[model samples]
Target: METIVPDSEGRGLLARLPGRVRDLVQLARLDRPIGAWLLFWPGAWAIALAGRAIARWDLILWFGLGAVAMRGAGCVYNDIVDRDLDRRVARTAARPLASGRLSLKMAWGWLLTLSLVGLIVLLQLERTAQIMALASIAPVAAYPFMKRITWWPQAWLGIVFSWAALVGWPAVTGTVSAPALWLYAGSILWVIGYDTIYALQDIEDDALAGVKSSARALGDHARGGVAGFYLGATLLWGIALWQVRPEPLALAGLLPMAAHLLWQVAGLRREDPADALARFRSNRFAGLLMFLACFVVGTAT
Candidate 1:
């Protein structure tokens, strides 16, 4: 019984599209918009917390578009590089490239097409933002191979995924500030937490394949690992908030988002892949909650 479609990442009508179209959609993980949201929010938060988000709505929108395009490009690039490894991982075995539905040549072509979309978004930003965006390339390119060598590949992912914060701040402020740096650091921990949860889905497969991940590193304490990461994130976020407003009360802004992260830790079930994914996807809302907190604090009198 040969599986023809990538069931792990694609679903609903998107999964039912014509074979060619569906393959393209799933290749970019368009069916899972949570990745886009997760990528977009850190930039959005940086903008909102920089105090001109309402006025600079256009930058926010451009960053959102950039997230979509770049994330797609990243997925395509990763798939092309990891096609062989992917075939051995159950959840990724049916990816278009791994399943033989799409050739590596076509995958590279798709990656360039998506990168063009990202380039268009880059042109909308100032030189500083453009440079910041370009700087992310090396880390992004290295990410697919991190698992082959490191127990903390998620840490590398943290650096790659949280990069939008660097771009977002300079796009508006015209310079990277302390608050933005703190926010990016916090986002790194946040990414580590959620992505570790995501990696739980492939623990056995990753083990069989001899790949490494934070989830495997944490072992029986995976839940506690996530909790520790989330706690570090909260502390960094709180520090970022305080740097912006310098008011002790501004720290309270993190309460809702912090509580949400805590709830994720409390509800974690390492044995259940569905539960792990649910926890991972829940970061979309966690991102929103943090954005609101930043907006409220950043806009305060």
Candidate 2:
């Protein structure tokens, strides 16, 4: 049997579990919660922006659970689809599917299990929210193939990952509105920016594997591209706040998030993979800052 190394991000936690159990946990990325955090924030932001953060705390809980489960399922599906490509990338070569620590059958079974958890959380949603959430299925299913056909696969990820904003706004307001649209739009750009940073880790291996990414496409201009994307996101989020409260102070809600994004861009070392991963992980805090802004602005009298 080949020795399997755990993903660096998850190694600490994974080291404490039994062999097979550890592999399963790693497969679901339970050991690394950053992806789930990113997936949950848009929904939380929408709920807060809909002025229901306190009234609909249950929805926040459900969305949080759903984010973890659904994100896990997405990772498993992506790993299964990109197993071959993963083997070609140094950063991803140790993933369960690519490393042969887990079989396709096991991966499929795990995906189904995680998806069932998502389904349970989906049942907690309103009919409109449920339908809106369901609508994301097609995009999510197609995401794994985007890198094969386009250099902007991150855009597709943005669409899929930011989908909770659509479901969340409807869940609270019972209808999708301009504010929700703006939040969703802004979130898409945010994802594109951060995922672009993430792709920096794989640029060389991706080139060798012929996998296209925004990071590779931007090349020497990646920092500028990230700056542009973050700027667009901040602007759209500002619009969302304005649409909701229409107060000058409402726009100030975005200042913290905007400043944080600026910090990420200003300090980003594009040539360093470790720096890229740290920057990518830092979006978890960025998400929290945005959520706090939404909560404060949405609840103001």
Candidate 3:
């Protein structure tokens, strides 16, 4: 059996789970926690930057749970919608839905289960935040179709992924502020850059399947495209911080994250799938850098 995905996964504790449980885990992507971390960080940043993060540590924990549940739900829904496309994509061909290891009904069931968990997390927030969170359903449902109709589905993904900032701000302050808006926009640009790196792994297969992405849209210049997006992200994040504190320190707080983005762009290897996946996964740390910056600025007197 030729492995479409690199057998690079060590399986660790997932290897200890029963066969069916492991399949379900794979279906929800619990085996790969990067997506959940990517999803969690924007909301965490928003909480931290809202100036009450230390006092509102509960928001971070609740949002973290929501990120995991909702990220899993989104992946399941995407797999369900893209099962045919998945079958043609090398990396996704072995996916439970694509391989028929999981029935469509089962996949839908899992999606609903995960969604319910997300809802519980949502209800923990203020009414304003709850409404803001619910508003995201339309975009999330529309996401699976974007790759088919648009070359820049990552942009749509950016909108959906960065929405946590919107929800988080209202959860903390009961309304959106300029800083939160800027942060959300910056995070959107960040997603486009990182997910574009992720799209690199599927560029060849996506081309064969008629799936369009920023990776293919930029062609050989995909590396430069990612660099541009990361630069835009850093600039917008600076603006976000500056709005909170018109100080050199707030902008300087962004230097570490900016340098990390530079590293990703400088090291990008478009032709190497393993290298692309590594760069893509490294955003998990990129996220940490941004969160620490947010915390510093948010808590600074």
Off by over 4 Å in 3: 1-10
Q: Quote the RMSD, in angstroms, for model 1.
A: 2.4
Candidate 1, lDDT over the whole model: 0.89
Per-residue C-alpha lDDT of model 2 across residues 77-118, encoded as one tens digit per residue? 999999999888877788888889888999999999999999
Local distance difference test scores for all models = 0.89, 0.92, 0.90
For residues 1-301, write the lDDT of model 3, one tens digit per residue. Answer: 2223531133779878887787788888988989999989899998988887899998899999999999999999999999999989888888888888889998889999999999899889999999999999999999999999999999999999999999988899999889999999999999999999999888888999999999999999999999999999999999999998899978999999999899999989888887888888999999999999999988995
> What's the true lDDT of residue 101 in model 1?
94
Candidate 1 — which residues are off by over 4 angstroms? 1-10
lDDT of 1 at 114: 90
Whole-model lDDT, candidate 2? 0.92
The C-alpha RMSD of each candidate to the native structure, in angstroms, is 2.4, 2.9, 1.9
* Prediction 3 TM-score vs. true: 0.97
lDDT for model 3, please.
0.90
